[model samples]
Target chain A: MLDLAILGLLFEQEMHGYEIRRRLRDELGLFANISFGSLYPALSRLERSGAVAVTESGGTSSAPLLSTGSLGGERAGLRARRSGATLGTKRSRKVYRITGQGRALFEQLLEGEEPAGADDARSFGLRLAFARHLAPSARLALLERRRAQLTRRLATDLVRASGDRLDVYTRSLVEHSTESTEHDIAWLDRLIDAERQKQAASRTDGARSADSTDPSDPHSGDAMTSSSPTGAS
Target chain B: MLDLAILGLLFEQEMHGYEIRRRLRDELGLFANISFGSLYPALSRLERSGAVAVTESGGTSSAPLLSTGSLGGERAGLRARRSGATLGTKRSRKVYRITGQGRALFEQLLEGEEPAGADDARSFGLRLAFARHLAPSARLALLERRRAQLTRRLATDLVRASGDRLDVYTRSLVEHSTESTEHDIAWLDRLIDAERQKQAASRTDGARSADSTDPSDPHSGDAMTSSSPTGAS
Candidate 1:
């Protein structure tokens, strides 16, 4: 899960270890307490596997430290320059950039089957966060897989509740759990409906374009807009 | 987390290892994939700590194997007896029962501050599952603590989404995550309200009972009903 989160972030931009940790907490809202102890080891493992390349910068270079446009990066760079450590023999900051191999690995992991014994909620959240990079079908599959998992959970909860000799609090907990799962399923249904409609509309546009001779039609522009990286309406 | 779950089960009734595993999966709906490899070690740890006591049974003993009244236990017992293993040198099944110290441990763990870096959702769910054992004030605190955690998460998610360069899918994921947190908080609010009402009603009953001279008034029965172990109104 940590690997997936790290690769997903690096897929967007090169980042040093500190920046990656910050984004994991602030931007991703998962792995909020990931420590440098685990983070450094994961980074080292990724480096050893050739999934990422590390480049040292910020020793004497006046260039900006981070590739990200966030002000936090600029401030960190300024602080480093002001400290006069740039003139010392200290090792430079190592920025990690995802290699082509890492990109392939990310895609593979994103599209892969979730392993057993994994934390299901975190696994799903991490994949959903990076679903934009997935093919449309793959994205739909991800949503459906999550829906199925929750559905099974609800079924089990109902079965357990039905014959339960459970105390009041446990009964309430089970009922609430069932309701939450149902709510999630309803939400996924909406997303699935939207995806199908978008896919159908795009297919109709493709057919119309093939039937017409116009090279610059408005419908083609609409198709491009709908299929843009954001995949938002 | 595993220890809490194990003790909670044993607090209800004594059970052998296999029965405990079954309940942990089928009843709790959490730790569904817990293997014997981990389960046995946890049981051993608990036994070593004097939290649980184990007794060997099923050797030439016709007594029901499990304290739980589930039909599954009957079948397992019948199968063991039918296979003639009950008469063999195969070690008798070990039935684990929670000790007084174990019950204390369970309560302490349930009411304790959640450790950092733990799986937050699982920790909350486990605590809520056993919340019937908590004092009313502790139960209210648990609900409020969970509410505060979700509120903070939602705030962070909204801030991240506001000035975000996130792709469409990630943006949608964040939005959905925010909505889910809101849904959870709303659920907690209802629980908190119910808890407060129950407390108030009991207090009113107490005041009335104190004012009355009759030791066996109808209101006393009402009070008893409300304070029953089931705690369901």
Candidate 2:
């Protein structure tokens, strides 16, 4: 999940790990802090796998002189210069950019299913956060896929609530949960309806403007705003 | 999280691992499948910690005769006879019941904070699911803590949206996500309000009816319905 978010951010701009964490927390609004422990390891793995490229360039080096005065710091800097100190001690800022391979991997991972019992709110939110990168059809598919998943979950919740064995509080909790799922489903339906309407509108606009300009592109008149529904997460 | 759910269920009834999974899925309506790999290890750990006791009892032996008369069946039968098999072919059934210590552990685990970047929809949902077991004050605290977490998240989300760096769709996604969090916080507020009203009502009732049944019990006049707002998840 973090990998998908990382690639999505890097696809926009090359960033160091700190920028990635900041963007993930601030922009994407997912993964809150995205601990450096997990972030660096994932970056290393992606770098090792050739999905992202890390270059030791283009970072402010104002404080490096004072930090590198110590003999031990000098030795560590030498080691870093040799093997590339990716962990960031004395400001060898590694700017990471997603490769063509990384873009492919990101798409693959975004299209993939999270492990069962782990995919609902966070995974869906992250995917939808990057939904603009998806093709129109793919975006529709994503919405529909989430709708189906939530529908199945609603079924299970309804079944669970039918048991009548819960106390007043637990039952209240279950009923409220059921209502929330219902609201989510209703929200998704509105999104799906909007997507379908937008797709249809774009198709009509495409047919009419086929002789003028390419209508299949995302910038057409009826693509985003014609019948935009509540496409919130 | 799973530990809290498990102990909550076991507080009601002694159950084996499979039963625990079923209850989690069907009753609590969380932890859909709870993989056996993790589940068994958790059970073993709890048993080792004396939080739960493994009693060898209470499982139907009817299914065992189905696949037994074939190769390796004789050895299985001998093993079952030796261990006095309670459920399956290869092993004795382990029914886990919460010890007194387990109840303490359950409360501790439920009250503990999940690491930042992790405590989220699932954590909040689990806590709400077990809210009935909590004291009224603790329950209100949980709801307020969640509200604060979400409120902070909403601030970050608004900041993220203001950058104007996102595409139309991504902006819509972020805006929608913000709205969703707002909805969640509002729901939590309702729950907290109801809880406060109930607590206040209980204090009043206790002052009035000094010799009656405990006014602050979970089943009192102001318990769920009196001031229950739209407290869905």
Candidate 3:
């Protein structure tokens, strides 16, 4: 499911494996960044499965194009190192693009909503990680949908957290996880709003942040901005 | 460190692998039970590394008996099946006991207290999961030590959870994880108290829960006789 999400995002833009990893980190804070433990094998698997195709490795002499995606700019340049270098040398990374089959797979993935098991910590992270691979509209729709689900859970947990009727330890556990999910849901809503704003703004001229006084500015204050991009403060 | 913890627990009693698994679940509640994904491999690795040694297989029977002075049980049964099962079930397993090397290794692991990086989720779970493997006295001591750590964390989080804080989303994430860990620490304390109570009761030639008066026993109102085990209730 996760790899499919990564592949779908890559389908939107050709990215080296490292870029895919960085995007996962930046775009989805809780999303597991692809590491050597999983990344190399997953790319190889995707190539074998025909879900992704890799371009030839980049030349050693080209100026390193740093990753500009979400995890801030500090470590982005490190993405270009050679696979075998000791230190300070650039690694050759294979650029991967989603194949036509990959898109169909992603579509299938989006169409089906797997049962979200609340018991698994990994699943919580996985769901949000894959949130971006959905069609932008579908992604917001899912966020609204998930927000509703979490709202219900938070309501129940609040009763538990505030009550003196239960064992203290058990109550705290339920309350803690509930609050965490609630935070994620609220952030998701903000993200959806931001995305919608971005879409509305795109329909006009593509300007960055709106100039409040310029009526012609697409990003004018007339349009409410969504919550900031970082899901967690 | 996790493997060392598991091995140390085994040295305390001749328990089935399932029993060791139970301790993690009921007591630690840290890592989910070692799945077939890691359990079989972990056991194999431990044996190969000579941290443990297998006794003679319960020969010729479908269920085999092996002793590591401390290690052995369901794992031996699994090992027995490993040799006889068809095709895919042929992974070899060997039961093991802590060698002198294993003991020394465990002692070294106990001396370290660094937070292993967030790189491996499994590693985090494993380390926390095996915390109970410390000597009962040592484990309880650590719990006391951790209680202080959690107290400080909970104090900080309590402020965040309170409505006076304005960073709603930020507060949510911090409070959630903090609350859960606090609950876990509290639960550990309860278990430690119960263990201490049981040990003290066992040393005395009296019924457990002997300190509390039993309401059900009409004649027990004034009597100094050992209270029924349910007296505490």
Candidate 4:
């Protein structure tokens, strides 16, 4: 879940790991909490698997100098250099970008079944925060499935409640959850609309990004949005 | 994610591990895939955590035996006697239920953060399936937060695409994702509506059949709903 959330969030925008953590905590409220222990390892694994590439080259030199910790943190620098000090002593903030291969993988993943189990408010929020990677079709499909499932479930619950004495608060609990799901689905539709508008707007530009227009864009370390040398092969 | 998927699907309705596996594959179309290996471990963990319980007393011992794989398997009887055994056997089927505590925790888990990084879709779905156990108010609050976040995000994506000649497909991709998010929010609303009806109906049936009662019904072995008794303290 954490892995999917991370990928989903990044597919929309490039972000540092810390930002990812913050979003997961404050946004989707997913279960299976994401922490440095898990996040860093997962990132490393993704990198190793070629699913992500870090934005380390352009700002590598200035990164180490901006260190907020003790100057004696030379150990950090030394460790960094040890990882292949390809360029001497420059600090680099490792920002990851999803690979086309990763995108295809994500598409396939989204096509699959979703994980189960209900979460508390906080956890679900975190999951949503990161679930931005799915294709619009997949997202809508999942929402529809959920809506149907929830509808049936609520009906069953009502039938069962025919003789029960549940308190108002408890009753509201069910209603609140159902509303939450519905609200989310509606929100997804709006997002789709915005995406369509953007797509239309982009077409008027008449030219692709420098990455597609000029191969030099890839070599230019400063080009954050350049398509990587690798495609979804 | 698979763990949560299994748990959440069960939250919607009780089923055996095999059925859970079948649903994960056949119903949900998850690409990450699940086997009895992962399913059983997740269920075990869930049971230990008090999110799920088994219902054993309902079936008569004299029930006709079927040549089911669960009971015929070596792990059946030994695992049952050691754990709660409830209603499953290689020879018989074990029916698990969700507990109140389990629901609360599932809700809580859903509201927490997911792991960071790309390429974790499998995890994402598993977490989403179980987001039903949270307090109603909290759930709504989380959904609202998600909607706000998506709004901000969709806006950002729009900004990024400005003045760019992004491919029609690429642009479409973003649009697709946005629509899905909108749909999710809408679905949340629907869920809330159905749940309200269910809760309202519950007040009428003060005492109903075990199936009709709240998932917290005591006699149902309640292990499937929450953490096991061992972990309760």
Runs of candidate 1 exceeding 4 Å displacement:
A57-92, A116-118, A207-233, B58-87, B90-92, B116-118, B207-233
Across all models, the iRMS values in order are 7.0, 4.2, 10.1, 11.6
**What does candidate 1 score on TM?**
0.75
lDDT score of residue A55 within candidate 3: 58
In candidate 3, what are the lDDT values of residues B1-233, reduced to their tens digit? Answer: 45754675555544445556665444433343445555556666777777666554344443434343445465776665567642253223343567766655554454244342333333333333343333334434544655665566566555534543222223333445565666656655775686477447745946544432222323321221232323331
Per-residue alpha-carbon lDDT of model 4 for B117-193, expressed as tens digits? 33233344343333334433334444445556556655655555452444333344345555655655565466556
lDDT of 4 at B190: 62
Q: Which stretches of candidate 2 lie over 4 Å from their true place?
A: A58-90, A113-116, A207-233, B57-91, B113-116, B207-233
Q: What share of the true interface contacts does candidate 2 keep?
A: 0.54
Structural similarity of chain A in candidate 1, as TM-score: 0.73
| TM-score, B chain alone, candidates in order | 0.74, 0.73, 0.45, 0.48
**Best lDDT among the predictions, by candidate number:** 1
Fraction of native Cα contacts reproduced by each candidate: 0.54, 0.54, 0.00, 0.00
How do the residues A1-233 of candidate 2 rate in per-residue lDDT, one tens digit apiece? 77888887887779999989887877766677788999988898898788998776533443333331244666776676559544444556778999988977876776566544555677888887767655566677788888888788888789768976665556766777777778778877887787777778767887654321223334433333343344332
Candidate 2 DockQ, CA atoms: 0.34
lDDT (tens digit, per residue) of candidate 3 on A182-227: 6566666776676677567755856544223223323232212342
In Å, residue A83's CA in model 1 sits off its true spot by 18
For residues B98-208, write the lDDT of model 2, one tens digit per residue.
999897788677667644456577777787777766656667788899889889888867866798666555676677778778878888888888888877886888745
Please write out the lDDT profile of model 4 over residues A14-92, one tens digit for every residue.
Answer: 8888888875544432332466888888887777777777775444445544433236767886676778764664444
Q: Give the Å shift of residue A175 in candidate 2.
A: 2.6
Model 1 global lDDT (CA atoms, 0 to 1): 0.72
Cα deviation of B152 in candidate 4 (Å)? 2.9
DockQ of 4: 0.06
